[model samples]
Target: MPTAHEVFNTRFVKAMNERNYDEYEALLTDDYVGEYPQSGEVIRGAKNARAIVEHYPGGLPQDNIDTRSTRIAATDARWVRTPTFTFVRAEGTGNVGVSAVRARYPDGSAWWVVNFYELRDGRLARSTTFFAPAFEAPDWRKPFVEQREAPAER
Candidate 1:
């Protein structure tokens, strides 16, 4: 049998990428809670979370470039890439897990999402996520640190 983290990486992430919200929801506990400290947003329950992703960018089913762009650039950066979402890392033991992903929007902007998740009854019970945009290192840090290339986006 695969470990919980293994299932999370291969199954949970696959559900998200496939946009199979139902399957994703199945992996979460009924009372699942999710928090985004940067945005001060709290998502309580699996259904609500599923709804958000189902209608991302524009809440309604309409062609709203302005809304989409604003939503994409919420992390405040101009990233260069076509819409892409990939798993960066995911590791966990027992009931705790840490997962990270790089999500690129249609507006050519990309951001990283790091999720600290807790599982209960073999399902996701809580998730606290932090979002950050990629940025070039400042010249001031060059003297004190050894520079290295950033990890390639998977």
Candidate 2:
């Protein structure tokens, strides 16, 4: 069985993907808070959920991941979107879930973000989001690093 946080994170992303504003707001607490440390912005209340839809008018890109570890899950998002996704860390408890959503825009802009959720009494009380910009590894570190297997190989 999936943890409560996993359920929440998955459903929340689903709502965003589907543009189900009502369903999205339903998952939030009355005083829900969403923080974006990278943007230095903190959004509060259920209304902001709708605001998110407005921001992503074209909807989030489709992405999915596969895990070889039997202990973890193989989130084949083919059920959600084509060409699936990859995850770094995706695990959750009743109150927290690390949602694995990473994709590049059709325009070639990509973003990686980790969403940290804090649920209170079965509702999302607070969420702190951190976004990272993917940068090409500097050539100066070539001697100290090893290449990772391609996603398909892994």
Candidate 3:
């Protein structure tokens, strides 16, 4: 069985991957608040969140999208620990992007959030998130290189 927090996070991830605006909207509360890092925008209410997702880059691209987890921690019923997300674009095509996110829950649950989102009667009232630039390899080509060793003699 999946926990409520897990279900919520999964839905959020799926919405982003599929670019299903309607589905995404349903997950958010009427008065949802969002803090976006890429555009330095603070959006209030479900309406604003939907609008931002519609215009945000990488929301859903025709190219391949891969989200890899480097680390994950969760409490029994409190909150989920930080999880580093490695987002790859056109993964095998040499173009990749990565982002790290740490979600904390005030009520103690892993809800796929960056800040404390206060929910009143299951309605979102306030939320916050801080974004930092993603990490990348200095030489992208290096990742694709395969090194071979010379033959060894007895």
Candidate 4:
């Protein structure tokens, strides 16, 4: 049997890759909230979640971008976990961004989410994600200081 975390990850990735909002919606809870750090926006409810995933920039359906799972770490029971996602444009014209998500299991193994999603009876409830911003920094480095030799040693 697949764990909730595993199921959610697989479904989320598949839906995003195929741009299937319907499939994505089926997995989300009724009351869902997606928090975006870059935009500081919170998408509430399952309807909004579907909309957000559909209209996501450089996302599936609209663009031929690809999302790859770079790393995933889950507990022994696969209840709580974090997964790193890399979004890359299909045309390779845009920059690739990395995002991490932490999933929580409220019930057992039924509903799961990256953000906030209200689970059904005895199912996973709510998901709150903390998105990290992607930024670029110059490769400039400071010169290393050289230590002076003691005069007595010379």
Candidate 2 per-residue lDDT, tens place, 1-154, comes to 7666666666776665454668878888888989888779888887886576546533333334321111122244422222122344457665776665664433344556677777888777888878665566679998999966432221
Worst 10 residues of 4 by lDDT: 88-97
Best-fitting candidate, measured by TM-score? 1
Q: What are the lDDT figures for the candidates, one per model?
A: 0.72, 0.60, 0.46, 0.43
lDDT of 3 by residue, 9-101 (tens): 456556654556788788778877776565687787888888876775322333343423222334445332222221211111111112223
The worst-scoring run of ten residues by lDDT in candidate 2 lies at: 65-74
Q: Which stretches in model 1 have alpha-carbon errors above 4 Å?
A: 1-3, 58-83, 152-154
TM-score of each model, paired residue for residue: 0.75, 0.66, 0.46, 0.44
Ranking by lDDT: 1, 2, 3, 4
Candidate 4 local distance difference test against the native: 0.43
- Order the candidate numbers by TM-score, best to worst: 1, 2, 3, 4
Candidate number with the higher TM-score (1 or 2):
1
Q: Clashes in model 1: which pairs?
A: none
Candidate 1's TM-score: 0.75
The positional error of residue 6 in candidate 4, measured at the CA in angstroms, is 1.5
lDDT of 1 at 65: 44
Clash count in backbone of candidate 3:
2
The per-residue C-alpha lDDT of model 3 at residue 40 equals 84
- Between prediction 1 and prediction 3, the one with superior lDDT is 1
Question: How far off is residue 64 in model 2, in Å?
Answer: 23
Candidate 4, 103-130: lDDT as tens digits: 2122222221223333444222345454
RMSD of 4: 17.9
